[model samples]
Target: MTKPAVDLIIVGSIGIDDIETPAEKREGLLGGSVSYACAAASFFSHTGMVGVVGTDFPQEFRDTWSSMNIDLEGLQTVEGKTFSWGGKYHDNMDSRDTLFTDLGVFETFSPELPENYKEAPYLFLGNIHPALQLHVLEQVREPKFVLIDTMDLWINIAKEDLEKVISKCTMLTLNEYEAQLFTGEHSLTKAAKKLFDLGTEYVLIKKGGNGSMLFTKEDTFLLHAYPLDHFKDPTGAGDTFAGGLMGALCASGKTDKESIRQAMVYGSITASFGVEEFSLERLTKLDRDQIEIRVAEFKDMCKI
Candidate 1:
């Protein structure tokens, strides 16, 4: 029997990480942009993940993605070690230092989407090299909506290429610092104005725990992060938000302004749960019912 069409495709790095927080440290954890985003998106849509790993990757992690029903046909496994990173978070939980990095097989990553994924309705370019993001875009055929996330590294080194990627995406997601770095404008409004000149239809600036703000040619929208007594780890929260946003858009079957507004809230709530545990532990345990409860509770908090 033929398989159903995939609603979303996410492309990014897949890695194993050693993380040290003020409280403790863990090694060989499943972590990466694609891993976090794909898992979160699976909760709301039929998602396909495109990334490269190594033979050293654990079977149990593969089993986890399988359990989420994420399409793995685009996942490539090859010789060599999986990309690995080590980080230590400070007492504030807002700042972290990279202890080490080993590119391993990831240094040569080249995303090649499955034939079935070429026409996916939604595509998310997770934080990866701009050239790679462009490579994936070249393969996709007329995606209904495309979202691209970038970092300061890309803005500093590949400004020209990153600009091209932004021009093609329906929305661009980045932190406030990255926005200023790319546009040289201290005011976020002016920074967004420069981005709009680049041709993206929308811009979403992530403020981490403070919450997020959305910008368009005509209006701006704001969302508050779900209140938490505290969160254990924040490694993948941003990726989770991006994935959830794309997934919610797919679930709604519309990309109108109202749908975009609702999807932003869904994305924020999903990331809130992810930070409660280490690695992907909390997100792996998340279910649709739990998400619905919090989404409603969040809406109630906003009502006058």
Candidate 2:
């Protein structure tokens, strides 16, 4: 397959987040699924983001993403305030409470891909309404691989639409709870199989601190989460992970099993950095050398 101009195209939310962790509280930080994912993916390839932001979106935020080498052609600037989310993480960082969510411009978001982005070989459909995800799928050209991310909200309220979205994607990424919710199966293995039966070629079940599991018809791979002594924020880790996975794949220009495994490692490594600081602070300061060194350390730690 010929490579498209853009290595990866991501469609999802773009907004500011108000986060309160056990250690600190910060308001109005640049966030959203597209923000985190594009940041991670930018490390490995030419990445572009498609999302809507309101007039209130900061100019600095736009410049930051531009500096990251992300194309913002598909990022629409509309009126009103950008979407905002507020959440507080517990001491353990395992559970969080939603303080408030103001959808704002995101509530009316309708993705419209730029002409140049329509043929991108790799596409990541971020967690959004199932109908919106489906709309994106229809707009894109024949993507070499399509990955979809989902949260529990869509599972409970839009199972049928979510199922339709699942059937169209090449892979699905969701937390373990979402896996069980979708299949009504307690077993991860069973849940994965059920997802594959739904037409997705692969299923990735994220276990948060424990790790992640990748399931395909012929194989199952389990990876441990990269260890961190202190975690400042857990928000957007999943989106960061997804970005790394897709970024690595785009960089390698391969979708083989070995490539996928390496992508998972990259994903875990990126996520470890995400939780070390709030929002994009750590990620923005990171360089390729830091990421490679950490990935090597991870390989050594996992080596038997």
lDDT of 1 by residue, 1-304 (tens): 2443688999999999999999989999999999999988999999999999999999999998999999999999989999999999999998999999999999999899988888887999999999899999999888888999999999999989999988899999999899998899999899999999989999999999889989998988988889989888899899999999999998898888789889999999999999999888998889999999999999999898
lDDT of 2 by residue, 49-151 (tens): 9999999999999999998899999899999999999999888899999999999999999999888888898999999999999999998888888999999
The superposed Cα distance between candidate 1 and the true structure at residue 237, in angstroms, equals 0.5
After superposition on all C-alphas, the RMSD of every candidate to the true structure, in Å, is 1.4, 1.2
TM-score of each: 0.98, 0.98
List the global CA lDDT of all models: 0.92, 0.92
For residue 101, what is the lDDT in candidate 2? 92
Q: Which stretches of candidate 1 lie over 4 Å from their true place?
A: 1-4
| Candidate 1: pairs in clash | none
Worst 10 residues of 2 by lDDT: 1-10
